[model samples]
Target: MTETNPTKVQLVQVDPELEGQRIDNFLRTFLKGVPKSLIYRVLRKGEVRVNKKRVKPDYKLQAHDEVRIPPVKVAEPQELPSVKLNKVANLEQYILFEDDQLIAINKPSGMAVHGGSGLSFGVIEALRALRPEQKFLELVHRLDRDTSGCLLVAKRRSALKSLHEQLREKQVDKRYHALVSGHWPASRNKVKAALRKNILKSGERMVSVAEDGKESETRYRVLQSFEQATLVEAFPVTGRTHQIRVHCQYAGHCIGGDDKYNDEVFNLAMQEKGLHRLFLHAYSLSFMHPKTGERQTLIAPLDPQLSQVLKNLSHA
Candidate 1:
């Protein structure tokens, strides 16, 4: 009967209402804000202790079992449960933070996280090439190849597993900066809708609001208002595919330069202002350290291109 969202470790003695449910799915519903993969990781790692012992992801709950659920960190995407600024348009190495457990880089726009779909190499591939001495490197979560900002790479499987669990439970805090068409209302603060994903015959992925889709939400705070555009901070409360972008569109404000979901006239105006890429940037990521259990925040400085666009808008 526990109903409110859990913000820290939890110990729930099973009852008749909770029995017979699979642990993973049960965690999915209990920690409704988290990603699935991270939930699975914690199960595999025994982070979710049942009666002080580990259980399988498929383990069925019993009425007497005592469940120990760990605290979660939240950061999400339509997918970032998951970059930076400046200098020579991303030619310079943008290492925001690095430790033995993970690497945070200021990912440039137009670079895939991993190679596939006619790409020979991407960021993960390039990092592997640069760090031959390291034996393990993997993305903890993902960002759109077109979106530029902080992306994390785990140095060890243990770290990956730890971060994944944290991500699933919404323990990581993620923030994005975006420029959207038209003036945004000060009273409008959130978008709540169901999102469905579709793949076109051309293999392009598209997401839209549909009744049968998964529940999704994105919270917005207007940062600055322009005559024809608004700059806002986006927080994806529920990670559905392209949740933030679609939420904006559902609210009648398409982000500038979004190729798939865009306003042609609005985009043209943005293009004239030198916005050739998506105007969304994952500017900041705050999360708990997998190793130390302390919280950390990584800041990705805006690249010169994005900075210039803001400048141009301000002057105009």
Candidate 2:
């Protein structure tokens, strides 16, 4: 088997017992989990060398030939497999901001924020595919897949570190707009509950308000009202998992189409009206520039479908 931590090639003194094997086969004996196809590709690209000279995969092994290998780095971001964009074609107009230091995308519902849970691609993957020259793009923070809003990404490592620090210090300001079921009793409210992680059947982590849960705080105010539902602006004081959703639920109002923690009947009604996902949008974000320390704010208007739903509900 190949070396477990092989970053680059190293010379080895040949033992008489293994002298006559084919060079490729001999090399494969030391490497584990590496496929022959990849080995061949590396060889064809002149990444493998014997005695300081590039050699064919079929080259014969010599007793003491010094093998050289170019250092192996993780596959470049641009070279990753493409993420098809057919599903999100309508949401393309939501890119609210982009710059050398940051990228802000208005993510839509039914799309994942990042690749995990057997998913093959996500918005970041597609972005990397579109911009091949950028060597790094790191997520500064995350919003739920069903939560539409301004998602931030840093273009460089230093920027990522700085942005994360800002988030920890509560220096970034985030606002979300959500349409929730039931009329709220109060126009302004604050929910101060702790959130505890719950495990779902699929082994995914969920959140619930519990007495012993981590501290979370969410402030909300009514924006508009329909007959049975209301739109509210929410500002979370602490970045706890599912803080807004749990706090809203505790307030006797739940965001529409929040399947994970919402009223099923209400969710179904919204689905019938073609509102199949959560009615939550990350409406605004403000933070100091990671490099220059200048204040910047990004905003994303609601997706057209959500806006249309609001209009229909208003007419009702």
Cα RMSD for candidates in order? 12.8, 11.7
State the lDDT of candidate 2 residue by residue for 1-316, as single tens digits: 2234446566665454345556677656544345677777888998778877888888876767777755543332223444346644433455677778878888877677777778776777666666669866768898987888899988875677788889999999999999888786564588888899898898987899899999899988888878768889999999987789888888878889887779877777777666777899999999999878999988888988898888778422
Which candidate tops lDDT?
Answer: 1
lDDT of 1 by residue, 160-265 (tens): 8788888899998889999999888889989999999999999989998999999898999998887779999999988777888889988999999899888999
> TM-score of each candidate?
0.72, 0.74
Compared with the true structure, all predictions reach lDDT values of 0.83, 0.77
Shift in Å, residue 166, candidate 2: 0.8
Candidate 1: worst 10 consecutive residues by lDDT? 77-86
Q: Please identify model 1 stretches exceeding 4 Å from their true place.
A: 1-92, 314-316
